[model samples]
Target: MQRRDIAEMLLLAALWGASFLFMRVGATDFGPAALVFLRVAGASLLLLPLLAWRGEVGALRAQWRPIALVGVVNTALPFALYMVALLVLSAGLASIFNATAPLWGALIAWAWLGDRPTPLRGLGLALGFAGVLWLGIDNASLRAGSAGVSPALGIAACIAATACYGWTANYTKQRLTGVPPMAVAAGSQAFAALATLPAALWWWPATLPGPTAWAGAAALALACTGLAYLLYFRLIARVGPAKTIAVTFLIPAFAVLWGAMFLGERLTPTMLGGCAVILLGTALATGLLRTRRSRPAGSPAP
Candidate 1:
């Protein structure tokens, strides 16, 4: 990759990593549904203009059904789940769990799409789940977060969210094949915004959020969701998905850094160990590492 490509990838990772921070800051005031609604709605506003400018709005209209499905599964549900998880879990830990999406995606594709894993990838799946189990066990305290939600519930929410992401990967490949990337991004966000609107209204916070919370919401929408997607697609177009997917591995590190810096979140030894194991497993499961010098069944691009 060129220096520009590398720099863009890093920026993408940073933006996504900071999403957890933004969620933590905003979720307290806006609540999960409202915060996620803001995110998708704002992202839709940003990307729709670009789609119109590129003359791909027709593609979105033509493929509205599948794109809307992707919006609900990929954007709305997962975003709300993460917002809920972030309420109780530390950003660093939640970010590590987020890294397990590929593992789940591999498992789902194996079952649903017949893209079975090689023996090495089977091992990767084992290792990844073991890491998740380790982290979950370690953090399974019944104590509630500031919002009075249990860490266990938070863990469950993260797993559910990642599973939704995993399922969407195969769904997109099968249902939305050949759609323009920008159209999918913009259209999905638009549909997600619409789907989440009622809940956002119903659960909107009684007390108005402060400026910091509002700023967090705006940044989450404009920077993390909108701009980050643009950077992600650019990298994929320039460097290809294999290299662009490296951003996934880089995100947890940045999340940990940002959490520590801004939220004063500290990591435990167990957390660090679990993160290493999960990333290692993800690398193997995604075919980033070769075990027998032969390609495994392809995992879909992130």
Candidate 2:
């Protein structure tokens, strides 16, 4: 990859990694439903105008069913689950757990799409899951020694959210391959906003969020959801799905950095190790580390 492309990939990683921190902060005042609702709704409002400007509004109207399904599985469900998980889990830990999405995606593809995972990929999945199990056990140990809610449950929620993401990724690849990524992003968010509206209303807090919470929500919607999707689609277009989705590997690192810098959260050793393992597993699953020995260096290998 060119240096510019690498830089863009890193930037994408930073943006997505920061999303976990934004969710954690926003979830303080808003319930999971409200937080997710605002995230999708805010992004939808911003993107709708741009979509209209690009003459893509009809794209949404045309593929309403697939778009709506994508919204439910990809945005609404996983978003809410991550937020709920954040209520108990550290942002860093939750982000690391969410990195397991590709592993789950591989398994889903094997079962649902008849795509066979190679041996190395299978081993990568096992290692990734083992890391998750280790993290869960570590969280449980910490919680047992404290007087608060069990962190293991939080990790579990994040893992479940990643599974949903995994399933959605394959679903989109198989079902909506030809749709423009922007249309997919915008339509899904709009559908998610609509789907979450009732829940948001029901669980709406008694009072409005303070300035900080509002700021966090705005950032989540505008930066994380809106701008992030633009970058995501750009990467997806430049690279194929496997390479583009590899951005998730860097998210935990960025999440930890953001949490430390903004939230004053500690960078635990366990968190670092977990992040490394997850990233390694993701790399293996994506075949980023595998090289063709049959081809000479500095030459393209098939």
Candidate 3:
């Protein structure tokens, strides 16, 4: 990848990493539904204009069903789940759970798409899930955090959110295949906004949030959701999806750092170890890490 692509990838990771921090800050004031609604709504405002400029509105219109499904499955539901998790779990811990999506995606593809995993990938799936269970066993306690919610509930929510993401990945591959990325991004955000609007209104905070909370929520929408998607698709175009997806590995580190720095959240040894194990498993599961076999001297380059 070019230096510019590398920079963009890092920026994308950082933006996404900060999303946890933003949600942790804003979810309390705005409530999960309202915060998520604002996020997708704001992201739509940012992306829809660009979609129109690129003349991709027709693509979105034609593919509205699948794209709307993606909006609910991918953007709306998982996002709100993450917000709920953030209420109880630290940004770093929640991001570690988020990293397990690829492992679930690989498993889902194997079952749903009949795309069987290689032996190495199968091992990866096992190892990645083991790491997840390890983290959950250690951290998913019945003890409630300051939010009066149990960490176990938070952990379960994170896992459910990742499952939603896992499902969306295969669904998009199967169903949304020829749709323009911009259309999918913009349309999904718009539909997510629509889907969550009633919940947002119903659960809207009784009092207005302060400026800091508003700023965090707005940044979460505009920068993390909107700009991050643009950067993600750009990196995919330039460096290919395999390389662009490496941003997932970097996100936990940034999330940990940001959580520690801004929120004064402590990083436990267990969390770090779990993060490492999860990333390693994800790498192998996603074929970012692969085993090579020796070929015969005269073998064809098959």
Candidate 4:
């Protein structure tokens, strides 16, 4: 990849990492449902205009059903669940769980798409889940219910969110072939806004949140959700999917850093250990760290 592309990839990772910090700050005031609604709505407002400018708004009407399903699974539901998890766990911990999405995706694809896993991939999946269980075992808040929910429950919510993301990856691959990324991005956000609106309204805060909370929510929407998607798609176009997806590895470190610097969230040793194990498993599962392909004995050397 070009240096510019590499820089853009880092920027995307940073933006997404900051999203956990943003949600950590804003979800308390806005409530998870409302915060998520604003995020999807704000992203839709940003992207829909660009789509209209590109004369791609028609794509929404043509593929509304799948797009709506994508919105709910990919954006609205997972986002809200993460916000709920953030209420109980640190941003860094939550981001570590987020990084496990690829592992979950592999399993989901195996079940739903008949993509059988190699022995190595199966081991990676087991390792990833072990890391998750390690974190859950390490956290006492899960049993204490200090955050009004057990930390274990928070972990479960995060796992559920990643599971949704896994389903989303496979669903988009199977059903949305030949669709443009920008069109899917815009249309899905638009429908996510609609899908989450009712719940957002239902659980809306009785009192208005302060300006800081509002700003955090807005940043989560525009910078993290909206612009991050644009940059990510651009990176994929410039650097192929395998290279572009490496950004996921950078995100949790950035999340831990941002949370420490901005929110005074401390890094526990267990969390760090879990992060390391999870990333290792993720790397193996995603084929980012694969063994060389062995040619058949009769095959000629290239």
Taken over the whole model, the C-alpha lDDT of each candidate is 0.92, 0.82, 0.92, 0.88
lDDT of 2: 0.82
Looking at candidate 1, the ten consecutive residues that score lowest on lDDT are 293-302
Query: What ranking emerges by TM-score with the best candidate at the front?
Result: 3, 1, 4, 2
Tens digits of per-residue lDDT, candidate 1, 1-302, equal 89999999999999999999999878888999999999999999999999999999999999999999999999999999999989999999999999999999999999999998989999999999999999999998888877988999999999999999999988998988788899999999999999999999999898989888888899999999999999998898899877787888999999999999999999899999999999999998987876544644674433
Residue pairs of candidate 3 with colliding backbone atoms: none
Off by over 4 Å in 2: 141-149, 291-302
Candidate 4 clashes between residue pairs 3 or more apart in a chain or in different chains: 142-151, 142-152
Every model's TM-score = 0.96, 0.92, 0.96, 0.94
Better-scoring candidate (TM-score), 1 or 2: 1
* lDDT for each residue of candidate 2 in 197-289, tens digit (9 for 90 to 100): 999999998899999899889989998889888878887778766577778878888998898899888877777787777777766765666
Q: Please, what are the lDDT tens digits per residue for candidate 3 over residues 1-302?
A: 88998899999999999999999888888989999999999999999999999999999999999999999999999999999999989999999999999998999999998999988888889889988999999988898877777999999999999999999999999999888899999999999999999999999999999998899889999999999999999888788888888999999989999999999999998888888889999998998886555334665432
Candidate 1 local lDDT, residue 83: 91
As a whole number from 0 to 100, the lDDT of residue 162 in candidate 1 is 94
Candidate 3 local lDDT, residue 186: 97
Report the alpha-carbon TM-score of model 3 versus the true structure: 0.96
Q: For residue 104, what is the lDDT in candidate 4? A: 89
